[model samples]
Target: MSEPSAGDPGALAARLAALPDEQLLAVLVVATAGRDTLAPLYEAATRLLSETGQSGTAPGVIPGTDMPPGYGPSADLGSSSQVDSGIGAVVGDPAATGGTVGGYTAGGVPTFGSLRDKVERRIGTAFGARQLDRQTPAGRGTEEQWEAREQAARERLAQIRTSLHEGEGS
Candidate 1:
């Protein structure tokens, strides 16, 4: 296919649509052209398929990725045991490790969470709402308020931990 003119979105779309899915992904790889960035994406795509018990080459893979040449087929991604589904799917599953504890994240790192909570926190801070800080308190918050907030947070956290631990026991 002939290259689309620099400013023509319609032509570019047409050209992209003409190729198969694999070819389209290959084009994307070339456009971005970076190994460090693409490797995780490639791994995730290929692992998603494998986790669902369908093994095939995922087209998003570039030259440095584990996927085979030309992104033909994924028969080479090793065994299913080798694939880690990152942090997303681990939230609710019993076997998922380092993802859930009393429905809170296993690790402090939360890749995704309730949008409302994020928005509320953002708005709260923006509106000059006092946040709980215990480690150091001179001008930020009074000792009483800090202690109260800290106690409340700990209580809530404990309840969640207890509930999660109970769930695991059953």
Candidate 2:
């Protein structure tokens, strides 16, 4: 077959089909990184791995084992058992050891709550004290009151101009 251009869909499909199962899995893993809405792609990769008798576990890990890495049936528990006992003691006595209880501090301060509640409380306190009248337009007075204020400002300006003129004549 002739070499096809990079933009050719047929060529791309052929090249992808020619890749081994491991390479295709790697490609799918890279494509799905930081992306959440690619369930079909994830399923395809899993199907390909299963078809090839490969597992999703790390290399050298037995597939059906429930133990974590570096831990097995014959794993040692020498000095670490003492450390584990100490942690157990601390976890058992929360109040005596000053540990947190139900996500609260030892001093009774709340350490867990939704941020939405706090935001709603702040907004309520800010807008609760002043009850707004829906019938009145905001930042505006009555027409007669506005006219009176404008007239008063005009008289003040006229008085200032008169004083400046009198000072100039003297």
Global lDDT of each model? 0.45, 0.46
Best by lDDT: 2
Q: Lowest lDDT 10-mer window, candidate 2?
A: 87-96
Q: After the best TM-score superposition of candidate 2, give how far the Cα of residue 139 lies from its true spot, in angstroms.
A: 70
Clashes of each: 1, 0
- Give the per-residue lDDT digits (tens) of candidate 1, residues 119-162: 66699886564444434465345777778999999999999999
Q: After superposition, how far is residue 88 of candidate 2 from its true place, in Å?
A: 21
Quote the positional error of residue 76 for candidate 1 in Å: 14
